[model samples]
Target chain A: MPRYRAIIAYDGTDFYGWQVQPGKRTVQGELEKAVNQMAKNPEIPIRVQGSGRTDAGVHALGQVVHFDLPYQIPANGVRKGLATMLPFDIGIEQVDIVADDFHAQYSAHTKTYRYQLSNREFRAPFRRNYTGYWPRRLDYDKMAQAIPDYLGEHDWISFAASGFQAKTTVRTVTDVKISQEPATQEITFEFTGTGFLYNQIRIMVGVLLEIGMGTRPVDDIPRLLAAKDRQQARLTAPASGLYLKSVDY
Target chain B: MPRYRAIIAYDGTDFYGWQVQPGKRTVQGELEKAVNQMAKNPEIPIRVQGSGRTDAGVHALGQVVHFDLPYQIPANGVRKGLATMLPFDIGIEQVDIVADDFHAQYSAHTKTYRYQLSNREFRAPFRRNYTGYWPRRLDYDKMAQAIPDYLGEHDWISFAASGFQAKTTVRTVTDVKISQEPATQEITFEFTGTGFLYNQIRIMVGVLLEIGMGTRPVDDIPRLLAAKDRQQARLTAPASGLYLKSVDY
Candidate 1:
């Protein structure tokens, strides 16, 4: 048996999430179906392990996953098979052969996620689908300055969702970047870290949004992280604007 | 009554086009309802007219519209009022006082619609929502060559959707500019015309697509326009990739 790794991209609108459930379309189920139907051994069950799970309406640009096959299907053939079998919105970005023991989640290095915000009084119609549209005035420079505070190892329990009960909330975020594209109303937040707690990106965006609006001081980010209480952080940003941009392993 | 022209933008995904209809959420109806509700005179009615109708899933960056008001409301008030009163997807970009007889549709000089096509085998999840996910091979250089055939006064009945009963199918398309953005698979078709027939932009894109894929000769465009039959055209692209980019009055 051989193992193959794939980079996936999907418009998360029609999907329930990455994992499939009964009666709902999901990225994992689609890939499994496509692989099983096309592979030499149609009976071979595939366990497609993704880097992480994204909420509904969120998107992925470089989501990494891996699965084992009973026969050798060329990397390009695997890509073409999944692409032809999947819907127009979901696609296999790249396919490569990998070690049998290679696990997408465990063999990992760092992951990066991006959240896009439209800082304009009126949102651009074409951009509204992917960006979080907020009419409030936002100070982009201040937000960019405040983004660095989230770097280093910190107990981000405050930013975690109330429903999320992780054993360890401490994660080392190597870099956090928030930038505004000049002459345009688009602002993007990029986070690179070994791991992230549940709802971490949403909460980080929410806190930065508060800072951008001048409702919170830049220095307050450290205090918020120290609080370690979910209620201490700002409200979570909408899922529609977040994306699992890349998984660098 | 003082008439004010309002520049509006909206994400048309959840909208049932721009026209008002029963059991459908339309941009026109939402704006009209919001304005009519805010009117000082409850008995009097108000209707908002847009520069043109944008079909469902189509976007607009510079769409102009206006409606007469029973009493004078500050431009800022109109912006804040409709934004707060109406749905979050639609927004009033700008507002100003226009001439007494200013009609958004009839007063328009040049209406430019951009037809976006993505020439990539793998559809980008991020861009799939905005661009038409065209997986076929396209000779962009050939597509550009076909533009000159549409740059003149010609009957565009063949470009229109069937059952569009118009008084005159003849429309003077002053210019048709097709440009490809380098380093990406983005192809933009800018149609600057006095007016467009129903589904004209999509049809024009379809003709270019045929030429791009080598299905039809680039020289056949002029002959197709002269034929005045919808069957002569290859196919009409989807409405999601079309945009009313600007309306210069």
Candidate 2:
């Protein structure tokens, strides 16, 4: 069996998430179906593991997945075959042959996640479908100032989504960035880290937004981190704004 | 009543066409509903007349439409208000008050229509939803060489869609140009004319494509036009590639 690594992108609107679930549309399910059809034996099972298990309606630009093929096929041939078989929205952006032991999810070194905020009264017709439409003014300078506070390793129990279970909450965030797009009303919160807990980016976005909306002060982020309780965290932002941008290995 | 002209852009995947139809999701119908909601009068009876009637799944960037408003509203206000009430894929690109005698469809001096062609074997995941995908290789030089033959006054009867009935087949094409996007697998054909018959641009694209694909000669365009029969034309290109880019009034 030859192992292949594929970079994928999806709209995430129709899909439940990246994981495979019975009777649900998912990125994992779509890719696996295509892989199985191409395999020499129809009965042979092929499982794909994604770098990030994104939540429902969360999109990705650089989602990495690994699957083993029963027969060796050129990477470009596999790409074309998958493109022909996959649905219009879910597509394999790039395919490459990898070492047999290479695992897309496990071998990932760092992942960059982005949460977008459209701080405008009216949403751009083209961008509204994918971004969160926030009809409020934001103090971007204050948001940028708060970035360094969340940069180092910390226990993010306060930012975890409801019912989120993890072995440990201590995670190293290498960088935290808040920036605005040129000539647009979009504000993006980018985080590069070793890994992330469930819904942590969205929760942090909500807290930053609360600060933007004058409901919380810039100093409150540190206090909230110290609280180590989900109750102290602001509301979770919508999944539409979050994107797994890239995985570095 | 004050008549206003609006420039529009849309992704036609979800729309039936530009005309108002019963039991179909049409562009005119959506605009009419939004107008009625804003005008707030049951008997106002606003009909948005389009510069050209596009077929189902055809996109538009500068489609012009006119409607009579019983009461005066700021142009900017109407633009913003209608945009807020409408869906994301449809938008008012421009809105302004024109002369009382102005008609969107009839008062135009010239119109420009653009058709997109995907020039690669592998399809893009995000673009497949909006653009027509083809697997065949295209010769841009041959297509570009053939564009000028369709430039001047002539009866473009053969280039119209089957069963299309317009009062006159004689039309003056101002210019026809083909260009490629830098570093992308997208080709664009822009056609400018004083007026175009129904489905004229689409059929021209088809003939151009057939020539590029080695199915027809570059000189076949004039030969088909001389035949003056709709059956002599090549296939009517898919609607996904056609766009009503602009209208000059």
TM-score each candidate: 0.91, 0.90
DockQ of 2: 0.52
The residue pairs that clash in candidate 1, if any, are none
DockQ of 1: 0.49
Q: What is candidate 1's lDDT per residue for B1-249, written digit by digit as tens?
A: 889899887777778899999999999998898998778546867888899898988877678998998878888888778777877678677888778899999999889888888888776666665677688999988988888889888889889888788899888888788888766688888899989988888988998998999999979888898788887885988777888888888
- What DockQ does each prediction reach against the true complex? 0.49, 0.52
Each model's lDDT comes to 0.84, 0.85
Angstrom error at residue B206, model 1: 1.8
Residue runs of model 1 more than 4 Å from their true location after superposition? A39-45, A226-231
lDDT (10s digit) by residue, model 1, range A97-200? 99888889999899999998878776565565578877799887788788988899988888888788777878899988877786767888999998998888
Task: Report the TM-score of the second chain of model 2 against its true counterpart.
Answer: 0.95
